[model samples]
Target: MPLYKTITPNSQTTVKIWKITESFDVLMEEVDLKPKSLERVLGMKSELHQRGFLSVRCLLKAFGYDDVDLHYDENGKPYLKDGKHISITHSFNFSAVIISDSKIGIDIEKQRSKISIIANKFIDYEFSYLDENALNYINKLTIIWCIKESLYKLFATPGLSFKQHCLVIPMSDNEQETVAWIDYEAQKSRYNIHFLEFEGFTCAYAIN
Candidate 1:
């Protein structure tokens, strides 16, 4: 098991990251998946996606939980049988999970320049501090996207627009943590957000 890193941000929240190197068959044999999960992974056309799916189960196993203990709501949000909040994400060769006593979200993404093309789609207020010509523009954009994506998972509210509702406060250079907000439907909520970069991938998590 390539459990890359583990973070205990607070007494109630834990984050785990895994670097995927196992073949689909290897991962398939390692995790005991539910019938529905088995069918879902087997149906994935992309081998990368298949392995990512199974790697999550492998992470669950490491956390002392099984596929049987995990359930999804109609909104597709993940939950544990004991009621701990859980969020998951995978990008390319990395997958991550954040479980907490309170609501939380986690996301991982490859830091690619291509993210700049769609920056406007999910970014709005952050533009006030962004520099398109900066050397770290792509890295910054990727972080913003990951942050908003995590917020989406944490909030799990329909009709929330990343560009309009999620806002990542200004992040300074070399800063690994920041704050974010969800301003929608006359309600405003705040969260503490953290992020890290490793092997060209960015991982971000939001916790309340």
Candidate 2:
């Protein structure tokens, strides 16, 4: 089933990661998607995207819920009908879902050198401590990017600039967790962030 790894970050949270290796047809055979979802997948021009979409449904099934129990709001934030907070993310070959009792967000990103090219766009405070000559510089940048992306998904608020609003505390590659803040419009909030790397990809999630 390619359910690569599962983590119970806390008593109230469950994270399920799927490593997509099956053909699209195989995935389609395993999931029963709503018409909208089916159409959305079909409309995608890239098979990688289609497969990633289906894998998310497969992870949902592992959680004992199907596409019927999942939905999204006007802001494009996903939610569960059973009242649990849900966040999702997928990169080229991996996809993950995090369901928690409190608001949460998840993101999976491939560790790429190009992330440094656009680092300035989403990185500001963290840049103060990032050493470009460090062996894990790219790794650190990818983690920060994943963290901010997760924060965006959690906040689901428009006009929240990643560089200007989100701040991740300094940490090394050996650290699996850290703290981050979202300071926007005088409503300041702190979140506990955790992340891990596997097979050249980084997966991070933020919990409110």
Candidate 3:
């Protein structure tokens, strides 16, 4: 049980992160997966993805739920059977989940310089505040990417463009939280964005 960290962001919300170091067989032995999840895991070609999937079940167990308590919508957004809002993310050796009484979303991403290559596709308004020459440029870009991804999971709306519709308010590296807005199809909504970095990975969650 490599439960890396846990945070109670609010009275109603819980976030759990897992550091994946177990073998696929070890994780499989620790968790009892629902049939669909078992099938999904079996279908994954990459062992890393298989481990990531199993690690999520591990996180669920830590959160007092299990694979049976989770499901996905038509948009592929995760939901909790108990009526609590849920969002999930996994990258490389890390996986996380955020569950709240209110609608919420979460994302974890590995900090990588490759994000710079695709920055234009996902960033628009944020470019004004970002300094490409800064030493923390990759870190900043990872945060923005995670922010947009979390927002996307929360919105769960098809055809939502990260570059055009989601706008992350500027914030310094020292800031723990900020705000973001989604303007799409004449509908507008706001979210409180919270982020943290650990082991060279960035985790961001959005609360509506």
Candidate 4:
């Protein structure tokens, strides 16, 4: 059980991270997935994805839930049967979940220079504050990307453009939290953004 870290961001919110190290067979044996979930995992083409999927079930168990308690909406956003807000994310070797009484979203991404290549596609207002010459350029971009992704999951709206709709307020590398806004289809909402970096990966979550 490589439950790497857990954080209670607020009384109503819980975040859990899992560091995947177990074999697929071991993970399969440990978690009792619903038939649909079992089929989904078995259909995954990549072993890494299958492990990440199973590891999320492992995390759910830690939260006192199981595969049957989770389901997805038409938008493919996950939700809890008990009506708590839930968001999930998984990268190459890590997976995370954030559950809160209020609407929330979470994302985990591996920090890499490749993000810089696609920066223009997802960044707009943030480019003004981002210094390309800075030593932590990739890190900063990763945070912004993660923040926008979390906001996307939170909104779960179709045709939401990250570049045009989501705006992450500028913040320094030393800051653990910031604010962001979503302006889409004449509707607007604000959220508090929190982020963490570990082992070359970044995780961000948003709460309204």
lDDT of each: 0.95, 0.95, 0.94, 0.95
How far residue 23's Cα lies from its native spot in candidate 1, in Å, is: 0.6
Tell me how far candidate 3 lies from the true structure as C-alpha RMSD in angstroms: 0.8
Better of 1 and 3 by lDDT: 1
Off by over 4 Å in 4: none
Cα error, candidate 3, residue 104 (Å) = 0.7
Each prediction's total of clashing residue pairs, residues at least 3 apart in sequence or on different chains, is 0, 0, 0, 0
What is the overall TM-score of model 3 with all chains considered together?
Answer: 0.98
C-alpha RMSD of each candidate structure in angstroms: 0.7, 0.7, 0.8, 0.7
List model 2 lDDT by residue over 77-174, tens digit each: 99999999999999998999999999999999999999989999999989899999998999999999999999999999999999999999986667
Q: Which stretches of candidate 2 lie over 4 Å from their true place?
A: none
Q: What TM-score would candidate 2 get against the native?
A: 0.99
lDDT of 4 at 131: 91
Per-residue alpha-carbon lDDT of model 1 for 1-208, expressed as tens digits? 8999999999999999999999998898889999999899889899999999999999999899999999999999999999999999999999998999999999999999889888889999999999999999999999999999999999999999999999999999878999999999999999999999999999999998
What would the per-residue lDDT of candidate 3 be over residues 121-187, giving only the tens digit for each residue?
A: 9999999999999999999999999999999999988999999999999977788899999999999
Ten-residue region with minimum lDDT total, candidate 2: 169-178
For model 1, what is the alpha-carbon lDDT of residue 105?
95
